[model samples]
Target: MLEALGLSTVNESVYRAMLTHPALDVAGLAAHLDLDPAQVHAALDVLADLALVRLDDTDGTARAVRPQTGLAALLAKVEADIAVRQQQIEAVRAAIADIAVTHEQHEVVLRLEGIDAVRDRLAELARTATTECLSFSPGGAQPADTLHAEAPLNAAALDRGVRIRNVYQDSFRNDPATLAHARRMATLGSESRTVPTLPMRLIIVDRSIALTPIDPREPRLGALELRSPGLVAGLLALFDQVWQQGSPFGEVPGARAGELTPQERALLQLFADGHTDESAARQLGISARSVQRLMNALTERLQASSRFQAGVEASRRGWI
Candidate 1:
């Protein structure tokens, strides 16, 4: 391998022979190395360029430089070249990182089709998350199949010391099985809270990636996976706000001492806060017709003829 240092076999052989036989002329060096005279001359020319040999102007003879000086200098040059290449590689890597950040923040949102795809993505996110996994599990009691599927994933994240915080609707408190499951998860180092309602089902991991349903009304339609930092940050803030307002998932209260159900109170507040029937139904994860039917029943229960009277009666009863 002196080839790597720009020396051919002929050049290296001539140089080594010349070093050992300083008194040998070109013709004698050729015989020593078993090379033709022209080949020896060509090797001498290359060796001189590599600083492996020097020309004596007085006698026009070529002499070999000491290996320690000549080889060391060539090695130093190789090292310098490597150092430059490393710097170039590092610069390219930095540029790629910047572009990747931009792409993740501005352009990446993947649509996951089918229940299996959604579960697969959730599994991946849970596996990789290192800091936090926050979720809003809306609607009423979770089905047995859902609890079964989610248990292992939640346990894995907790075992890895990743904080898992979940918010469920207050209606879940009325379901014994769901409440028990929530308590069990809490015992395993997960935090669970219940609100009157949730805007949608959402899961955010490490505040860097989020997944939500393509249609809030139909989770069966699958999910939309988001990596955009701005969108994820907004969803993260929403989770924090709702989580702060929720009651811990323990010792389920009886719809506020049997007067108004948690859902009724939330619906009243929604209406008073200027939400339309459709919007209120969306927040409650029900249909608009359901909101209207519920209101009609409320009016009849309060002995009121209209929504205005219902509102007034509800306020008088401290139900709003």
Candidate 2:
């Protein structure tokens, strides 16, 4: 413990020995500690510099001071030194803060490599968010474990009154875990919506910074952290366009028999626009099998013998 205050092991041993035998000289201390006289003398020099020992002029001998007095003085000096170093650290941090901002502004876009880096940046952004957090999670049902891991951070942002808006693919409605997560988020003041398709995974914090996958097909490879005003504005505009088209989670408008759900309407619209089944599945964040099943169900419900006939019936029913 005393080593942290600049005392060596030998110095500490010698000091302890002095406390036990207050009248011991350097030679006596060496014999007691099984050390050479030179080593004991070196320890005595350090202890004396630290005011732990003093020379008695009348006897020309070294004496240990009361530990309470000597140790207290040493502690006071250490604390003062620590305070000065802390001030220096704070000064350096303040000096770097502006430089960091300037560097980010100049770079405009930073490539975050590796999953850990991406997650760390996301956490940092969430922790510092003050006004709003907008996210687009495009894909099928989100994993329960992933949602569980993010719950605390999301809840913390909500507690700070940070408005959170999330957009997920319509297929997430079929996922029990995602549905439960959405309900929990809603209780924490987060708003969610679902659309047939989303451009990419994205996060925008307070409209000042944005994060998006560099390549949506290989999202795990890396991500881009964007701060350029123009790029951020463009992303924000795209998000707004999609948000306007999304149906609120768990609150889709009621539909009668033969009436299409929002997701079905979107599928039909994509099909009408000449999107292939595979392309539709990719856009809708579902399997081609699911798309085929939805189409088959639509055909049966419309009493159509073919996809074309189903589309005609759907159009006639204002379901498309």
Candidate 3:
């Protein structure tokens, strides 16, 4: 009964002992239960704090202990606490059930607040996925413990012959734990890749469902889950476009471009000739707006942060 009430084994024993005997000191109580005196005193202290027992003055000799005046009342309080917690759990479960039941009408996007909720939803998606799985995950997010919770779902999907393709940022390539995960996924026939960088987190399943972050920094508030085939197809098209230009799995994405933009060519030429953005703007007979536009486009296109790095990449691709 004490265990059912969430009491530890030692706590259960101590509480039971307190109920049976009254006004006994720690040593006397320990002798009765064949437990160490110190252990008995610690248990009594804990029980006292819990309001399950009280210290009784034994004529200035020893501080004996006894069950609280209203022992039954304490039990009722514990019962009430358990009941309230159970109700809360049931309410959350009901909410999730409602979300699923209402899915036929809408995409059922959720704005969850906590990391645990995000992890749980991701795990659910991975588990429920029937066919292909695509993930575009960036760095600095996702907890270390996330892999353990998601591993079973991933393995089960692989068992069912799911074609899983996961893309990580280049930074993840050197992470020992991530590498181990990639190897394990590969062993299960899932293809994993590391790109130079990804703008945000993305997950698409079977070309039927897609999820992406609206604001990568505030993932919970910014997440968008699409279930419509049209929206899914659009997201998949975007994924394919990036994947076609991205480097292969386990390969370093160092200065490689499977395709190049005309703006990128001009940007690289001007940058290589030691021209500033203003100079490039003048040389191209375009305004600074056009130059800045080209720079920003290159950033998105190559997933590069600065002009120098973009130039290096363009040169490596023989675009210069």
Candidate 4:
């Protein structure tokens, strides 16, 4: 153990013996250590140089050896050094916490307004993800900019081995854009599914972060980004719950082209005719809630948002 303090083997042994026999003549020290007289003297000389031991001349013939009292002070200093190092470590941890807070603000998390902002955010999400992208778009609440514009980013993400799992509404079965988008995603090895209308839109990237809109009527008008793992996980749970009930993309139940429902045709035509939710609901003799519900189901099925987008998607798929 004394060797750890940079003591030579002989010096360490001599010092240990000196501690036990605080004062001893060279002959007695050599005999007790089982070392030669010359070697015991040599070890004492080295220990003296290290301030661990010293000569004593209590008797007239100068035949005594003793340990220095300063060893106690050295041990005390070691304890003080450990305490100082522990305090320094705690200070570093506090500084890191401050830096993390500053970094969160510097990263600029905020609401993005309008179609342009929505488009940009989606592109940003696609570019930033490392492992996978999860999208739970209920009833096709996704904007037009997202529907047509994300193809390139999706393709790029696919090339980089990023998996994309998108859940849509069952009404998307008749949407041309939904079909085309699903086809493109499939070609890139991304997975898509359709379910009955879900109430909210959820987008998650890399399992570390997520974004969700506050209101379905104006999704771009307000949204929140969450970095907290617990919150993101909660949102993911809601998404998975809905996803479990969804059908795989491009899976139509019936055998033929006329297998589409009248509600699907009406929703498609009304959307193509440029009717807003209030206007469409008025023409259909239904409440706006019913229209919103239909919109949700349609977008999920068609993977669309507004009726106008659904119309364009329908034209592309020859469903019109």
lDDT of 2 at 169: 89
For every candidate in turn, the CA RMSD to the true structure comes to 33.3, 30.2, 25.2, 31.3
> What are the clash counts of all predictions, listed in order?
0, 0, 0, 9
Off by over 4 Å in 3: 1-108, 140-142, 220-222, 254-320
Best by TM-score: 2
Report the CA-based lDDT of candidate 2 relative to the real structure.
0.83
lDDT of 2 by residue, 1-320 (tens): 68877798888999999999987876788899999987887676567557787766687467888888999888998899899999999987984574367556797778899767888888899899999999999888886656876788999999999999999988887788888999999998999998878889999999989998867887877888888788789999999998998888768633566567777888898887657789989889899999999999988988875565576577778776
Name the 10 consecutive residues with the lowest summed lDDT in model 1.
Answer: 249-258
CA-lDDT, candidates in order:
0.81, 0.83, 0.65, 0.66
Model 4 residue runs over 4 Å out of place are 1-109, 140-143, 253-320
Give TM per candidate.
Answer: 0.56, 0.63, 0.47, 0.46
Q: Residue pairs in steric clash, candidate 2?
A: none
User: For candidate 1, what's the RMSD?
Assistant: 33.3
Per-residue alpha-carbon lDDT of candidate 1 for residues 1-320, written as tens digits (9 for 90 to 100): 58888788888888889889999987899888888987886676466546777756577466789999998997898899899999999997995576467657766777789778998888888788899999998877787778888888889889999999999987676567887888888999999888878888899988898999978778978987778777788998899899887877774534645377667788888877657789888687677887998888887989975554566678779887
Instruction: After the best TM-score superposition of candidate 3, give how far the Cα of residue 55 lies from its true spot, in angstroms.
Output: 89
Q: Ten-residue segment with the worst summed lDDT in candidate 4?
A: 59-68
Candidate ordering by TM-score (highest first): 2, 1, 3, 4
The digit string of per-residue lDDT tens for model 3 on 136-197 reads: 87662345686777677888999988889887655565567877787787888888765544
Error of 4 at 177 (Å): 2.1
Residue 76 of model 2: what lDDT?
95
TM-score, cand. 4: 0.46
